[model samples]
Target: MKLLSTPTRRIVAISFFCMLAFQATYFVGVIGCATYTLGADAAGVSALVFLLNVVLVAGNLASGPLIDSAGPRRTLLAVCAATSVLGLAVWLAPVSYPGLVAAAMALGFSFGMSTTAIDAYPRYFSEDAGELARMNSLNQVATGASVVVGPALAGWVTTWAPVQCVFAILALAPLPAVALVWATREELTAARGEGAGCGAGAPGAGGEAPTQDAVPGLFVEGDATPAPDGRAGVRGFLSDAAEGVRLVFGRSELRVLFFIGFLGFFVYGAFDSLESLFYRDVLRVGADWMGWLSAASGVGVVVGSLLVLRIPKQRLSTRLLAAILALVGVGSMIYTGTPIVAVAAVGQVICGIGFGALAPVRTTLTQQRCEPGNVGRVSSVMRMGMNSAGTLPLLVSPALAAAFGPQAVLFGASTLAALIGLAFALRGDE
Candidate 1:
């Protein structure tokens, strides 16, 4: 697609491979492996999840400045390399409690960095709002592809092969992605400079000056002055990141979306963190089927993203987000309430579809509303909110499950999430 230049396309492809590896490693290689090795009791799982999220939250906070200062190529390379090493560490390290926790933290940081870099990297290449949406949607497709397959592959491999072998495979998965990203370093860095002049120097087609909000790419008229030429220093990163947070909270729409996004991802993190255990203990499903169920959601997400193309263009508003949130809520209830695997799978697909549509819309809306200079920071901040929100659930869900039963805990959380979405949906767009 014209929305993506060759280098950007390469970046997206690398993102896909990296996501595939990550999904595979995380779901099966890390979580599943840990469950098998450590036993899937609530306390152990909860502690592991809490540790991972703590590190992940830290990574999310730092990723924005790191990307801005270090550049995406360098960030990608560092994240990918670190991830591969961690995967190996998880494999080779003694599987004692401390050893597993240490491995989880390292993996969490790498994964956190990877997500921020991927989300921010594409902004440099998109020329307009439409192109940005298309790029993000396509990126969703790549991620969805991984979501569809990663679990199934991981489950199968871990089930059949030695659990350690899954991590070994994951260790090698990112080498190619690292190599591909390295090849594009010059182009990627050059785009960073090219991005500086995006809205600042270019008039819209037909020689009309772009409006403060109308121009595409990162910097629009009246936006924060574009970053200085060449690499950003530590002080510049802090300034840019702080400005980004201010911009996000300063806007009503951005603020609202971040709030809703946080709720959505909180439910997601809780659900995912407990899903394997729930299915194992409550539903009697095995690892392979667990993977398949996840793939069902992946399919739904891909379909939902594609479906967005058919929706007519209009200004994004709270109404649209509310509706999608409501849809997700309903789906969550179905998935969490059901004991039947098939029924739960159906629910998973429904939730996935809602999220699939919501992801691109939210991302594009954020981009459109953001001043170019603040794009990376704003995006990172919202993401950080979601990631941070998940931390509480990671720490507390196991305790809740222990007291109330996992099924009750999940159902209650899903119900709250659904109500939150529905309530927001009922509220008229501001």
Candidate 2:
């Protein structure tokens, strides 16, 4: 009876965790195989990974409008189903690289597409900027938890069942999504109704309804009424997408945010890609411990996310971002010198803190700066920065590590962080 009490159903929250569970397994598998499957062809897998990013960019850009038009509920449901289906395809048909490429495209589009739209959910039900940050943090926690869970699941299934069995297990991903959607159907519709309630001509006058203030995330100004109904296959997408791009670039703040995302996470990539190998080979840790090591970094993210929830959004975002640059730089540099298993954990946690804490600032700032019509397009473009930043480091990191040994790599990461932090700190209130 207590469970049946009438409370706001967090269907979107449930959907996200479920989706993340599946994604974690897939991501771990893909990354795990990058070195092995690609083998001497490791160079090629790096390129393939970058190629997958292109699809990510396209999917990200398109998802904004899709969510804008059909709303998050329908849009996410379709994407989840598509991801599950493709996960099976990737499992069942382990074909040539070209087939894998096609599968990658589908997987990237379907699975990755949910990120932006899902991030926007707080506006549908909550208005407190801090609450929105918490929602975002919840996703982060879910991501970390799944990171812990998914790889373990993949490990168990791989030994007991065929690799294909992994796909079928993954197909279970969208199951919880179904329940989440059904439970929250009414609330989502109400949000769409509100958004659509605003006439098309009104630029910033989104659905006039106020968001729920009880939650701890950011306020959503534009989840306004549903996109105009009728004719849902690619026509409106082209027109709206073109407009969305035009509008986003027109704003100046968006440009700055784009740069921040690229520079900040670009530095992150430098460290993250090479850390595991450093831990395994140099620090002399084992495979079994990799999970704990990874988890060590994830703990930082959770702490950072929770911290973000407490901080005043804009008031603290810049300062924290600046501070983290120094923390990450110094922290990572420590790892190179000590290389002790215990010390490595400390450094990883600091790096993770920087990583987790920074995500909301970059993301929230981007959304805050978006024009009503351009939220979707702008969301995609910011992701483009993230994609670029994330991709370049993988290829560049190994080279950097090779050219100047492991110590150099850590110090270089430190330098990258220090420089970025100083830049922002020097910006002085803008």
Candidate 3:
């Protein structure tokens, strides 16, 4: 089919390869170290997560606007190239704390920047909601594949290779991304956008302007508006950011999403940060077993993302979200209470599914509720929910777990998570 010959196919393929390089090298080399071993103080893990959040927020907040200006392909390619370079730098860098922090920020910032950039790419490629969902789902699936592979490969580096060698390997993942960018150079050009993307300004559409539809996190300039610098004006950025903020307070959907993002981060942040530790310390499982658990969690993400498409949009309810999350909590509670890795794998899968369902649903709704002109800004604002909570809670949960106990902290955290889910379920979006 000509579709196979088209830019969409290439974009999806290259984008996925880029993710594989990123996820593996990233989780294995840095994130693994950043997370505290059960042998270490639990607070170490929390602090690592906190650092990740701070770096991600700082980088993404600034970069998100840039993506809005540069367009997705350019932004995505730039981030990938930067990451590949940074990974090498990490490999060669000194081992002191300052060096680590600097290198970590470079790696982290590149990864975070890439995420925001690539995420917005689909907006420039797809033509309708179905296409958008398909792209998102495909990207999610790619992400799942990376999650499964990243640790297993990296585990080898973490074990056999000098820990520093891990960065060398991490540096390689971006190679394909770079090559793909080059080979497909023309595809990412005006021709790649030959077909319509989401709306209004889609490149073709028989010379008619892009349809005036709203897409969160993808704010376009004024209709037929092209700035000389190719960036949104300061006024537009601030105004759009402001609109999303106002919506967060005034819109039922946005409010629910923000809270849900917080709860997810607060509860799941600590839990995920401790996954390796749970196996080693709590269950006495080995690295292979730990890797399997992580893989299983990846499956959860794929399954959940796939399931989101089938979900009836009209029936969306906070109560239902609560129930789903409550069940996820149950799975976690069972694992912790029983100290079973198998059981925890099940919980991870459920949580993954929940994440998939919640993320797309929340994003779609948030996009739908925002003003057509301010999609990108609003999306970024709404995103702050998960980002803030996900990163911040890492600081607290690990410390709390260390001070108290993993079992106690997990149990309490599970309760709080289920409570948030239930509150949303009962209260709905409002």
For all predicted structures, in order, the TM-scores are 0.76, 0.66, 0.75
Question: Candidate 1: where is the Cα deviation over 4 Å?
Answer: 1-6, 60-71, 92-94, 117-137, 188-259, 362-384
lDDT of each: 0.75, 0.60, 0.63
Best by lDDT: 1
Ten residues in sequence with the least summed lDDT for candidate 2: 212-221
Candidate 1: what lDDT? 0.75
Cα RMSD, each candidate: 7.2, 7.5, 6.3
Model 2's lDDT to the true fold? 0.60
Q: Candidate order by lDDT, highest to lowest?
A: 1, 3, 2
Task: Give Cα distance to truth, residue 350, candidate 2, Å.
Answer: 1.6
After superposing candidate 2 on the true structure, give the runs of residues whose Cα lies further than 4 Å from its correct spot: 1-13, 37-42, 68-70, 92-103, 120-169, 186-261, 271-290, 308-320, 334-342, 360-387, 394-411, 419-430
Q: Give the C-alpha miss distance for residue 417 in model 2, angstroms.
A: 2.1
